[model samples]
Target: MTSTAASRPGAEHNGFTGRYLLLLVALIWPAQLLSVTGLLAGNAQSQIAVHFHTTQIAWFVLVSSLIGAFLTPFVMRAADLFGKRRVMIVLTVLGVIGDLVSALAPNFAVLLLGRGVAGFYAPIAALVFAIARDVFPPRLVGPASGLIGGGVGLVALFGPFLSGWLLDGHGWRSAMWFLAAASAASLVLLMTVVPESPVRQERTPMDWAGGLLLGGGVSAIVYGVGRGSDWGWSSAGFLASVIGGAVAIIAFVVVEGRVAHPLYELSMLSRRRVWSVFLATALLAGTVLSAGTISQLLGLMPKIPAVSDGLGFSATKLAWIGAPASVVIILTAVATGWLARRVDSRYLLATAALFAAVGYGLTAHFHHTVPQLMTVGIVSAIGLGMIVALVPVMVIEVVSPAEQARANGLQNMLQGTLLTVVTQLFFVMMARDGRVVQGTQFYLDAGFTNAFRLAAGFAVAGLLAVALVPKLKRLEEAETGEAAR
Candidate 1:
């Protein structure tokens, strides 16, 4: 729609028909499709690994997610400064172009770069939420946000099966083609049907200084971590990257403190309640991401007792068998949403942490059969679902209304940051522990052993962080954070 036909401040009062409602639903499908499953290449990991002739398969997820984690705040802030429609359209174009780059790449470098570009999908959901608030009435905004936020349930339910068909039947490139095609369709609908949001916030200059510091710091650190297995851990190159990145982060915090419109509001970190959310988010979110990758890796093992005993399934069978857990997770998320309203969120977090700990810890020792692994997955899925649902709840209950958006943005930033660390950490362990057999890299039984043990440890640490969380002051009347609003 053109600006002349665009929505205005009071246009939300203008009632919509089923036509507009369908448009909103259309907008949500791609947002969920790309943002949640974009970097999740586990379904195609074995093929991509063998095709690229490298076990640094972690980079497939790490680099894309690192790019997303480091840059999402700036992108979301850009949406707020410029316009949502223009920014969302730009991100969609970037995704399509990125997919094309990834699909046709001749080497890993080009594909990695393409995946990084595709990270633009991460901030699209936040923009979707803002657009809904601008376009819908108050009565409908809640349902719209709920639909967009938790709608991942339905996606999760079918995502594995769909990936199994596409990746197994056509090849890994088919998956990229699917995302690109879906994103392209979403882009056309978004441009033709979704009008620009007229709602405005306090207009401020973009915080390029803070963005550069944070981005540069994160790039250096992740570069160091991702390469640590290749570069000796104590090597000067690794030391320089880690030390330099830490210094840059310190500089970012100082710069943010002085800047009028900080990219990441540093003062919020001073609050105990808020920092606890961040700390827990960092640890628990990492474990959550690691779980999917761990399961995929487990599925590919050869199932030799005492040497390597795992499901020994192809990616297709892995996806089909894992479908049961996805169903449980979706159901648990629904139940969690209901429970969050009635229970103390910290109790939820602590309970989730324990469940995750037990599930991962037990799987470290006993992963023999499909039934055994399925039980472990179902147990962990419950905890993972609760943590996924409650992290936002904890953010709202802990942060004051004034700083809620920044808190949420920073929370997302922290989640991505820790996820990168955990993924790199696991791969590093695998590299260190695995063996080369007949020119093929094999992750030994010991590697999976240590990785699951480490995951359990991280969950326990998250539980400690949960203990420190206290109910924060809230303006129940004020708007909650944008992810759910």
Candidate 2:
């Protein structure tokens, strides 16, 4: 059953203070580095192509997504092994380096590497969620985690606007400079403000073999799925990568079964209490994680005067178009995050899934005009806010304090892997009937319809997944029981 770590002495603060606010900001800043970087690239694909003389603009974001999927578990393990604060400092440095590299890159190759390194910042979100749980009392955990979860709304509202403004005024590289300066400031806060996590695991041998195997398997699968569209879905190369990845993952499990010190606690993960959430996570991937990217792409695609039915808006224009939805998410995320402590997460997830299905179904047919897509986006934002606010809370609450990072980290890996595959699937669906336009490709309206339909279908699948989750109680009960002992 779902539960939170029992409250510790002196951790029972009644309200947050300025120090707490500063801590949360320090925790969220590094994560925003990744978000702003991706939005910068995603919203300015056309500009990147013109500036770099290449058509593979999506790679700028995809490479980072792949690295996040591959590296997060190890990073989280390192945090638990060392200290969250120390690891966060190192990550901030890495992210700042990435920001500088991307900003000053003379060629697209260097930019790609820079973005991939920035993906190392991906684990910071999970770290923030875990840290809030560590520092806050049981009563405050849900709302605190919710705010951490809602940090996306903070970035989404501003990232697009800032990226668009920079893209319009100073060019794409200038945005990276902004991220670099912001990251440095964040680094100082992490070094000074955020406390190290108190929950610690006993020292043990590092599971290098299992880590390599797991990373390799996950990396192979993500890469194969991402490239399947261009390499032919049934091509020999695609099959080899997929098969190899599966073999490696299976072998990793075998090795974990026999290891003295496992990279992940497989026995713990397989518990019904935990595994159900992971299943829900996989299904949720197809919902918000999949549909979100599709919506962004459709919103930003260049509108061909007489050739295509795409919306030819610049980053700034697209950001304005999406502003209504961002505001809705900010409201819904706070509400759902608060509700998570009272209502069962399964119900929250179910409601979120249902809303997404309806919004995507509407998007399938009525997406030629601004009002139509805006309506779909606003409707879908309710679900987006729910997933962002509630899912992370559910993930960390299911385990004890010591296992929190590994549990959250594993979920990130699962979520990141599935997101990469599912998003690529949507890109492939729309790209099936695409045509070349001035060295770039644009999908037909019919292709977009098919992809939107598929997105709705995934939302329906998520609803089924949520139905299988058992009801759980508030964290306060768990704390009460611990106090009586």
Candidate 3:
């Protein structure tokens, strides 16, 4: 579901100005899926890694990142070549099926496969932005992107708490089942509400060699980092995965540069603004994502059983723990959208990053008590909401109208990939004995201050990333000015 741009004459002149809002409703679910990755990360520390006999939590991060990196750009290009609606529907269906497979998996291998398969569908982060770019005027794009992101943040607020509760009570599998339902519903919504893009482009052939090479490269890097602690960094398996992954990426670069219609347009990478948005998006996602992971970890190993286990509440009840955060995100998202319309998006982005850093820095210190935790969560949610909402809007600002869909998709893919990779690295370093271990004692003894400090550092980096964006804008404006003269 997406807003088609008012490209055709009289489309905006008629009663169609607000029509994109209708498509945006359908777009919400895919963006909702982004929360699933966070949920999985938090829950995996409790449920999956040990069951799979993995010593390191990095594997989960690695697999998710590899899959996302491989699939996102490919899906984006596909959307451009075919049609967004067509590709979106296919992704939805595949995601639904992937969820079912993940929920019903009998073994770690199957579970991993199912989770990885879900990544292939690529979430709606990019797609929603593309839709906004398609449907709205250039001026309205920034606000529209924020509006859609706000909707997505609403989902994020609830998804993790629900996932945490389900993991605590029934098991992680139940969480997967929940996602499957959402995916199916999204599919149905798309079918009913999404309209085909009136401005379709000629189809390009699937770049099989490029896709495989890129996928293999990412998988190898993810695998190496994920299993490094368990397999030994110097071991053949680790070395091969890392070095081989790098080679694969190099191969992809060469192939893409040679191709007439590359899977990823190399020229796009040369654009300074695009890179700025990419780096900022990755950092912002990683920072806010830490919130969900911390929440799940806290639930898994509370100071007492009653608190950790939700006081014997049902999974449904526990899910509501995240509802407040979700509600705030929705409100803030709308607020941000309104604000974006008034101010430059760069300012909005920087403010969000600063607030997020402060919120995470504060939240990390108050993890000893649940009420304190809730307060932190609320503050962080507001900050996180502000940051995440800008992802697609940045894309719309940097890319041309025709390139919006693919560029947005690739943006999400890269961000998700980076987040996954970083999550794996963090887990590997943070976990005890390279296993899905909880750090309750560490938090109690050393205090939660350390984690908060680390999170704040990440947030600071994100702020810097946001600052870089404005520089790109200034550069573009200067180039335009010189051209005008």
Which segments of candidate 3 are over 4 A away from where they belong?
1-21, 44-62, 136-140, 160-171, 233-236, 302-324, 433-451, 471-485
Compared with the true structure, what per-residue lDDT tens digits does model 1 show for residues 1-485?
Answer: 11223433443443445765775676677667653463247666767776787756778877777777677778767766667778889988988888788888788889888888888766675566556655665445434544454556566667776877886688888887887788788888888877766544466899998888887787788889888877889999999998998999899999988988887667678878788878885689668766667667778655554444445786667766767777876777667666666676678778989988988898787766777777787777777777766665566566543444455567766777777788788766655667654334557667877888888888898899888887644323335323222
C-alpha-based local distance difference test score of model 3:
0.64
The order of the candidates by TM-score, greatest first, is 2, 1, 3
lDDT against true structure, model 2: 0.75
Where does the lowest 10-residue lDDT sum fall in candidate 1? Answer: 1-10
Residue runs of model 2 more than 4 Å from their true location after superposition: 1-12, 305-307, 478-485
Total backbone collisions, model 3: 5
Q: After superposition, how far is residue 4 of candidate 3 from its true place, in Å?
A: 12
Rank by lDDT, highest first: 2, 1, 3
Better of 2 and 3 by TM-score: 2
Tens-digit lDDT track for model 2 on 1-485? 12335444445456666666666677667655555655666666667766776656657777877777777767887877787777878878888888798888889999899888877776776677777777665656667778877877877787778877887888877877887888788889888887776665666777888888888899898888888877888999899999999999999999999999888889877777687877786677435755766666677666665444567777788788788888888899999987877787888888988888888888899888878877888887888788878777777656767677788788778877777777778778877767666666666787789888988888888888877776654555443212311
* Candidate closest to the true structure, highest TM-score: 2
lDDT of each: 0.70, 0.75, 0.64
What's the distance in Å from true for residue 227, model 1? 1.0
Task: Give one digit per residue, the lDDT tens place, for model 3 in 86-174.
Answer: 88888778778878888898987787788777766655567756665565434445555676677656556566566556676677677
Provide the clash count, candidate 1. Answer: 0
